[model samples]
Target chain A: MKNTFLNKKNLTWLILGVAFFFLIQLLIQVGVITPYYRVTMYWICLFAILGVSLNVIIGVTGQFSLGHAGFMSIGAYSAAVVLRSMPNLTGLFIGMAIGALISLFVSMVVAIPTLRLKGDYLAIATLGVGEIIRIVILNMKITNGASGISNIPYLISWPLMFFFVFVSIMFSANFKNSAIGRACISIKEDEIASEAMGINTTKYKVMAFMFGALIASLAGALYATTYYVIKPETFGINNSINILVIVVFGGMGSLTGSAVAAIVLGIINNVFQPLAEWRMIIYALALIVIMIFRPQGLLGTSEASLKTIFSLDTYKNALKGLIDLVTLKKFRVAAASTGKGKQR
Target chain B: MLEFLQQMINGLSIGSIYALIALGYTMVYGIIKLINFAHGDMYMIGAYVGMISVTTFKLPFVLALPATMIVTGVLGVVIERIAYRPLRKSTRVAALITAIGVSFFLQNAVSRIMGAKIYTFPPVLDNRTFMFYGLRFNTQQIAIFVTAILLMILLQVIVKKTKVGRAMRSVAVDQDAAKLMGVNVDRTISLTFAIGSSLAAAAGILVGIYYNTINPLMGFAPGLKAFVAAVFGGIGIIPGAMIGGFAIGLIETMVSGYGSTLYKDAVVYVILILVLIIKPSGLLGKNRKEKV
Candidate 1:
């Protein structure tokens, strides 16, 4: 009887989650969410997806990559090309899948050879690779080079997008707690230590790179599918910078922080699209401000766990605990040593 | 053979511009280990200053060129003090991010004030062509080469002979040791930026005259290309930057001229991949692992 009651609660939560998503989709579709906010919200959702993807590599794995837009450009162009060739909803799915796979493969090819280098070289190499990809796309015969691929099929709906976002979030969050996640965090903390401990540090780093690229490609695929158009410039160095800012602004290790930063940046980016010439300047300024003022990101490595956010006492204690840790490192040291003494 | 010679001549001019610009990247990278993405934008600003000096200030070509270079050099110092100085001891990534922000801010600020349309810059040299030994040459090309070489020699002298240069070198080798030796590390950094920015500025102005037009986005391609050159030649070495800059110009010019123009990006990337796969330390840079 108790088991049955637990199952019933689980079912109810699942229903509520689905219904909640459906309700939001309905509101947006029927104009209840306001057309004034649709495009901006869409960008937020997409950027949330991108930020989470980047957080996998940049935040969790602690690797500096500058070629994110290269993968994204490939995804976007692949989807755009495929959808242009075949204009069915099924085609959209097929194209996105194919595009994403291709992106994953290419990212592996790039990362495998390059990720071995540390510090400034990786940064430079990734940047070079990104520019190379941009220039290649700019010169390609199929994608129309600098003119950009246009008139892609608009095959995305709000529900479909929401579904993908949910899947990406769920997958990323789950991965964050997995054994692989632990290994990655260990590597990030100390590559030498991790290597000494028999972690295939190179393999794990490559995996993180591939994983981040795959998710970024998926986001890019979705972006291209929805807009029915994408240009090389759209996925150029500046786009890479924007995504980097989001990842940094979100707190590198926190999925929830990544999502929040993405959404906030997305809204701002979309709203300020009218400032076409100075849009990049605004992004740059925002980055400088964020780095100077709030280097840990808005959420600072804290997850938006339901229990933590919902419980008043938990939130207060967590806040107080964090303050204590920051302001009183000596106290933390004393506490740790005392705990060690107790164990002894 | 003659055609190849002409191509080499053309490449030398453009390559020198890249070398000048790469100096900005290499110096900043050597001192602080941060790739100032906005260094290219500083070149753009220099060009604009030169344009204003010539057209608005009504200075002669030579006077305007040096004046613009000085202005740009000053701007570089100001930017270093304002945007980069605070984050000096921070992680390399923080500075890199800040540089990106500064680049965008300057580009946008320029666009907002100058408008988005491509601006026409007045020609500095007469478009006279000279033929020698069945080879044709442009006056502007010759002038570009001469000016760049003169700047290179001047730079070599300053870096090698000057006391400030010695101070700069010491700072590059070990910041702490240099500071302990009574060198003002901050001043050296400022001076490095000033000199490097002036070189880049001169390149920008020279390109404006060579190309006869300027746009806000003009610096991006050359900036990236020059960065690649810095990487190719070994980023911290001045001589390497010069060689790498010319090599890239030749590679680009030859590839674009020989192969379809479309393959330009492919050629460069292919080379980058090959070099990285073979020699990750660059052609000149020695391997120094980051001791994290």
Candidate 2:
């Protein structure tokens, strides 16, 4: 376990990931890509982080939090406030750290009450909490009211943003594979069973929630830097729902799927920007269609295993398994309907 | 003293509307345990329908109100059929996300069709403020309060005395058992949605008249607040929802009247959080232990 991070395979993947991001940065710096494309990629990185972090809570832990955007707002404001004094790399790091700490605190505060309650109560509570956070920000003098905090220094360059995104992905993946992650999954599978097994459900639930909030705040810090503005309203229920959509669409509990969905949906958001009003309507419709047809999401619970990162056989087998599942589901649906008809 | 009475009067009117919407939320949640996020949009649609009936078709307020109720009620049924029924067996999170999706669809679709502008509701009743003693009240307030109370009483009688209502209660307790008992569970659920949505529609029209304005996105805030009200009252209980709605509405009005108007919405949310924290089952709800 101690040597795992230092192993050759892990180091190779790390290097490859860095190289891939660096190549993209080089393309942008050398004018090989449009500024718009560069911006879109930045959004992808931000959203991917958001999606993966939320997956830890909703997907892995099986808790519903409609307040990720509230945590994001906390991070955004904390980072922005810190940046007001120090607008350099040191400030960015300190700001993000501060943002993460605040988010963890807030998550703990929210979790203590709602985590003890039964089923989807947290969702409703968080929905209200998120709105409360936004409204409080609106009335606060420090947040500059509805005009929002703007014109922060751009400390999050493409490289820095990519590095943070990489860190988020790696951290989440490691967590997902670790003992604590397993505990979280067990709770999700069945909270009572896990509790009966002597698993401290509340402790793991809070930890996962705080971790998700930390990553969300980190994303928020990056969002504030990249866009150079942060508005309270932007981190409302709509934003929370958007992250939930990405998590559900990417297949909950599947980190790789979250990343993929985030990138895809981010691109879709940009492409449909011309018809601004229709974008949300289409996204909403897509959500309904996907839920109806593929409730398990595109990837379901299948995850990208690092051991099979470059294995063609693994990919083929996974694809074949997915096809089998789809056909099996179709057959079951047909048989059930016909069976009902026969009963009549 | 006069001002206090005025504020209380205002609070009751708004609270009546909240109670109406809250009933819808409570009824739907009672039956399905899913927060019909689109329920608020039903109210919004109802308001828009009322707006159309009055402005475009020149219908009277009485005619417009029922039209809005029927349209919104049917819309609720269709929404449940298309989005909710398929995902009933899935994870609660899936159903919730789908509800949010339906909400988004309704809000955006209405906005697109209506051009996203705030329309002034036509003057239905004459602006006649009657003063009794030291407190002043308007015709609109009286109409809203009277209509809201009558509707609530009617709902109470229906739910308490009717056969369909009994089926709804049975389904809420245990769906499989209800089905075994020869209840048409699906129809019962649809009927619940219909009744709830019609109440929300009534609230919407009343609010449109009181506020003298209508918009596509008007339902979002009030809808959320009404959910908070439902939770505050005891989510699955009918009377709890009514009490919760009035409490939230009064609290919001008072907060705005005495404190900062900006914190009004925040106050309602704060109430929701506090209620969940202190009493997750709400004021009227009995705490049920989850079974393994």
Candidate 3:
């Protein structure tokens, strides 16, 4: 584990991340990055966290869960409730803890009952769970019943949001790099085969769900703190689908893809605020078009690692593939003409 | 006793609409093993088309109903061709996502064109309530019940007695074998979509008339409930969908009547969870173990 973390390649990426972090801070301090841009940055970070967490379930574990927004609501509401009594940073920690705990419990509860189902059935069941959570929130007196919990404390700066984003990405990447992540990926590849290999498919699936739900809860807590308002409607099926969209757009099972897609899409969402109503339509079309043309998504199963990029290894492979395709076409033409000549 | 009977009657009326929508889900799932998420949009489109036929074109209820069905049926076929056919060999997850995208596109497009606000449906059926043995029944209720039941029976007859029906059942059983047996698999699939969409269109029109109001987003909740009903009965079974729809409608009405109306939607979801956990195969479906 220590070696993996301190490996020369990973260390380079780590140092680069720190440098980028410092650069962003310097820009913010120098007033070159405007306040509006800072808000956009916050959103991008939040979405990155969301996209990565959801990727664990949808991408790595190969389970279709539409209840992520429910977990977020749990985090946001619990955080809001905790903040109501104590308004300090410690209070925020307590809120996030409460949210994470509850979401973990909820994931376990729901997963136990519905994880036995496969494919679209599991998807619908999770969707039902999400709807149930939303409705319960809507009716709960403590949630203020649709009026929502308001005036929560906030993180107060860009660097703080960046800190959370960086931590979340690293944490998720580390988890994806671990043995447990391999177990989860095996399940995604073939649950029956994974079971045959003596992997505890059920246990791994539940753990993946719990971990994703826990992280989603944290993102929810951050969202609550950042916005200072928590509405039941805000954490509905639409939000769950939005996160799913990000995961799919990024290439399922690719952590780097999730982060990149989330950041890019987040910026696009902010820049095109006036066309917000049309955003869902566009996302839906994008999903269809992408699924039809490239089911592997924008990045496929590969990542933009430093070695591959700096060394141009991927470009070389693409050039090789192009040459192979041209040769194969010529071979086919020659074979077809030779067959015609033989017939003549 | 009288109030309970009235509630049961009301439940049956709403249940009929659910039954219509659920049949579409069942047929499509039976044939292709896909959830056809955009199906709910077919219902919404039907409502819109029915509304247009009545309010804008001055057609009678009778004319509007068939017109809506035809329009939605064609629309369903088009959707299958454009959005789903190419992804037939792809992963179910991919197809599912595409289905969602189609649903989203339809919903947003409709909302963009028609505006999101609720519009009062033009009164077509007479609203006079008649008391029979201390149970009240209205014209709209009777119409919905009779039309839904008749349509369901007609569907049963077509499926059981017609050549197209035989083709559909064969394709549903095994697409490759059906193709080898000289069945036009593509055309049969299109027919399935057409039948399902038309049924949904009927349900949409009935819902609009019953509620006397319509909106672009109207299909979302009912669509969900009908899906639950489909699962409740047995996803791939025709009669299962009908029974499930009525059971759900009854369950929902009873909950609203006896319990807090705030938790009505929650109750439906709870039932779905319980049903899924306890008997994933549903009421009428046989358990089929996964092949390793």
TM-scores of the candidates are 0.90, 0.94, 0.94
Q: Score residue B149 of candidate 2 by CA lDDT.
A: 97
Per-model lDDT: 0.80, 0.86, 0.86
Candidate 3, B1-292: lDDT as tens digits: 9999999999999999999999999999999989989888899999989998999999999899999999999999999998888777767888898898898889889998999889888898888899999999998999999999999999999999999999999999999999999999999999999999999999999999999888888888888899999999999899999999999999899999888888988888888888888888889999887786
Worst 10 residues of 1 chain B by lDDT: B86-95
Candidate 2, residues B1-292, lDDT tens digits: the string is: 8888889899999999999999999999888889888889999988988889888999898888888889889988999888888777666666777888999999999999988889998899777998899789899999999999999999999999999878989999999999999999999999999999999999999998999999989999999999999999999999999998888888988999999999998888888888888987899999877665
Misplaced by over 4 Å in model 3 are A1-4, A311-344
Docking class of 1: acceptable
Candidate 2, superposed: residue stretches over 4 Å from native: A1-3, A307-344
Ranked candidates (lDDT, high to low): 3, 2, 1
Model 2, span A167-243: residue lDDT tens:
99999988888999999999988888999999999999999989999999999999988889888888988799889
**Where does candidate 3 clash, by residue pair?**
none
lDDT of 1 by residue, B100-126 (tens): 788888888898899878888987679
Sort candidate 3 into its docking category: acceptable
Off by over 4 Å in 1: A1-19, A269-278, A311-344, B289-292
State the local distance difference test value for candidate 1: 0.80
